[model samples]
Target: MIETDAAGKIMFARRALFAVLFLVTMVGSLCLAALALSPGGFGIFDVVVLGLFAITLPWMVAGFCNALIGFVIMRFSADPVAAVLPAVELVRDDDPVTASTAILLCVRNELPERTIRNLAPMLEGLCASGYAERFHLYLLSDTGDAELAIGEEAFFSELIATWGDRIAISYRRRTVNSGFKAGNIRDFCERWGNRHEFAITLDADSFMPADAIIRLVQIMQVDPKLGILQGLIVGLPSTSLFARIFQFGMRLGMRSYTIGSAWWQGDCGPYWGHNAILRLKPFTEHCQLPLLARDGEIERHILSHDQIEAALMRAAGYHVRVLPREDLGWEDNPPTLLEFMRRDLRWCQGNMQYWRLVTLPNLTLVSRYQLVLAILMFIGSPAWVGLLGLATAALALCDDPADVMRSDIGSVLLLWILVMWFSPKIAGALDVLLAREERRAFGGAGRFIVNFAIETGYSIILCPILWISHTIFLFGRLFHRDINWMVQIRDDHAVPFELALRDLWPQTLVGCLSLGLVMYSQPWALPYILLLAGGPACAAPFATVTAWALLGGLAARTGIGRLPEETAAPEHLLDLALPAIKSASRPPLTSSV
Candidate 1:
């Protein structure tokens, strides 16, 4: 009890420190925003601009804090992972596998062949390690498409024939994915939750080795209070340039960001829906979805259930933790820019639903704060795009540029915002460069630095491109247009220009108009606007080029954005034969994309 109390106090102190730093950064940004907009007088336009800027600042501030803290812990701590998560010390190699676990793979119109391909190795590893008996495989599918269901049924038969004897394998499909993934899992909890002490959830794209799985189960066995334990889900190495470069940047920023977040967040860490282990009984009982009233009916469900589930689990007095390390878990990223936007929009829709649960009872303050942050993650897009529109209006309306805009303050604010926006990735790069082993793991300093630069440019262009998509979708959401939660294409493929144009025409139009107005009004500010606007203007070409087979093939062959897995292929990943890893290595196989 005393140790627990001390841990709680330590966690409180960390949060308090984070709050102070976050407030300082936000307040400073607001001051700069005010100075940049209203040097002469604070008009209605300036007030609105400030309001939008305020709305948009928290996400950036939180990112900056998480990145900065994560970087410090990563660089200074002797054993970074163990320092953040002391439970690491409890999991010894010989920790007995006493608890029964359910390997739950949820499918929704996904390719059964791909699912089996990913599952085969995991099953073999489990059997080889002699843990197969303790783990049962559940194919929790919600395939509404009849044709897809046929394929799934056939594949499940084959899957059963091959490995059902070694490890218990079962397949269950719902005609409709009523609650989507959360609903699918809820069904599992009702039918089979009692059978397993813990459940390891896997998305169609997600893959975990037997060792990672056993390690997680062991961690949970030791920590009775631990409800959910999430490992860092690295992107499976790809031949697609889009996934490769995108994940490289994500890899850099994610390490420090997650480490810092895990340090402060402690037990109340994030559960990213998949690539995680969950205690079955408590999750079933305490984490029930609250009735969402949409247009005066309790028919709606929470789209983004992981964060809320974490909050609920914490409220139930259980620790929701994340293991801040890579190589333990892997997932396939959207192979093209267009596919990325589609997936992002679904998340955008789901996260926007957090407004309904932000006030749920018994949740810790930090839990509620996380919900708010999740909402802001997507909502802030409108504010950012609003600020852009407001700036364009301010520029066009003013006879003199100095009337509504101050270039000196504006430039500083721009630089500051960019720094914060990219702070995590920058902090990550610094962490790698500072460490000899990490740098070498990323194919030495030269290759790592080159990858970092390319990823940086890719990110700058990608942010606004996604932001515009978010902006448009959020507005449509206001009018009751919702995105369909469909199966995402996991494999790499070429994105044709015509298809790119069809999807990104709105971004292109908005970009061109916004830039043209800024250029004609204030020609000098063209460069500044280009950072955000250039992306939207060239969204089509950007999408097409990023998905080009030849370019992607060349990048994979040349190790342009080589990850650790590509540099030194892991034992388990060798089987997958990831294009990038295979190209870089003598024979084999990763990042977050």
Candidate 2:
């Protein structure tokens, strides 16, 4: 690993270069666009447009630069050094496990049967690894529903009876879930953390190979200063077309992006809550979350706790880092667009809550920047919307619509924005294309290209819908509206028309308003306006459960949007753990209450 001071210096230099490039590009582009839009003079409308541009340019620039750096790093670096832990060979079958570790499976009102189905294989694998005595597994439930709790108990009882003697297995359900998942974990730390050196937290949907789990423990044992080691998690075993498309892109993009991020973050990397191993002593002592005061409400719980925990760990002088290993961990994605939006809404609120803690005492500058970026991720959508509105108003009020359309600089700016927006996906595709092994794993060049094109098209159609959903969600969160902590919908089911309409009317209204305004102001720009509005206008229908099923089936028959795991899984444990892919048509047995 690079020395801490040397790494910090390099990261600072890279960040400075990125900032300079971003400012130059954004200023140059905006100035050209402004000249094209109004060569006569600057006006109030132009000033508003420029202000919106200033607010939104950083997000665009950051994304492009990140992708560029990631592409270069992944293309050139064969084996990047891990930032947090020293490299070690995998433990042999006869190697005696010295440290005690706990696997904490945290669940809420999720399907107990499904959870058991996923867990049974991992437990079997652990026993097979010949280190069963060294590791214990805990079923940490926060279910409040009486019937669901009983079902969870029944499942836990059966699982314990099946494998209790093979490994230490325990179950606990909270009567009152005070702070959600974070609180559940804190409770576990208070009760059992002292007994173990490390705890590997897992979500209900998380799956990791037993060997990978062992490797994490080994790495942590080697590095006493390591507080958290996060593994790269990719979406897997998706059945729906929407999920397949979304996850395929995620799998492609995350590998390189994570490596680049880890390089820059160095010792102060992010913790994504799960699919990570944490040193119990430091975590328990340093990462206890305190409530934030907001609008007369004292003791307001943090919605997103993982980043804060990582920050706290760093504040206590422990290194937190992410391992960018794509082959290790797996997770599930929302099966439908509406469900995805629902999940995103919760994340939007959680990330926005970081604004409350960005200036918390004892945070490193990098940690504070991480918090600020988290807030900007959601906030950028609204800023983009404002920019669009200002640009549209300027166009509508312009004395010469013909001149605005004739301007080559305006067209160039539009093209540049599109390129920057999709650069990450392009970079990911290039990474795959350049690597023979990666391309082969994606089912050869032809199939890979087909999948890439389909995913890109799907993402474009879905982007506007997300933009509107996130903007509204951000506004609601700012107003201190409470989000009901509910179980995530994980199965494929058709959304009710009424539900879709109720959820998506704001998007539809925005689409209609945008189209109407554009048609009134510049009929020549109708195509751009329609493109902007189409996704939102059709979001309700597109979000129908029936629509997702049909699209998924069509993609399946066409042999497009196939994930590498679906084509050929690298981990034997995955096949053993999940013997059969669950059918999308199977209804979820539990409610997300």
Best by TM-score: 1
Evaluated against the true structure, the overall lDDT of model 1 is 0.88
- Report how far residue 23 has shifted in candidate 2, in Å: 5.0
User: Per model, how many backbone clashes are there?
Assistant: 2, 2
Candidate 2 lDDT over 1-593, as tens digits, reads: 56967856877886677567667877886776676557656677567766766666666666677677777777776555443223434334345667999999999999987777667767878899888999999999999989889989998999999999899999999987877789999999999999999999999988887877887888787778889999989886665767878888887777656766666667788899999999999999999998766457445677789999999999999999887777668888888887788788888888887887888899998899789888777777887777656657766787876544446776787788777777777788898888787776666688788778877767766888888888787777667687767888877677777888998998878877777888887878777766567677777777784346676665544445666664465555345433123232123222211
In model 2, how large is the Cα lDDT of residue 339?
79
lDDT of 1 by residue, 1-593 (tens): 99979988998999999999999999999999888887679988889988998998889899999999998888789988998889999889999899999989999999999888888889999999887899999999999999999999999999999998899999999997778899999999999999999999999988899999999999999999899999998888889999999889888888888998888888889999998999998999999787576566446788888999999999999999889879689999899998999999999998998988888889998899899998898888888788778777777778887887787998899999999999999999999888788887887787787888899889878988999999989889879888888778888788889989999998899889989998898888788888878888899999999998899998888777788888788888888766778788742222311
Q: Each candidate's root-mean-square deviation in Å? A: 2.6, 5.2
Over all chains combined, what TM-score does candidate 2 have?
Answer: 0.91
Which candidate leads in lDDT? Answer: 1
Model 2 alpha-carbon drift over 4 Å, by segment: 1-38, 81-96, 294-299, 402-406, 545-547, 571-593
Single out the weakest 10-residue window by summed lDDT for candidate 2.
Answer: 584-593
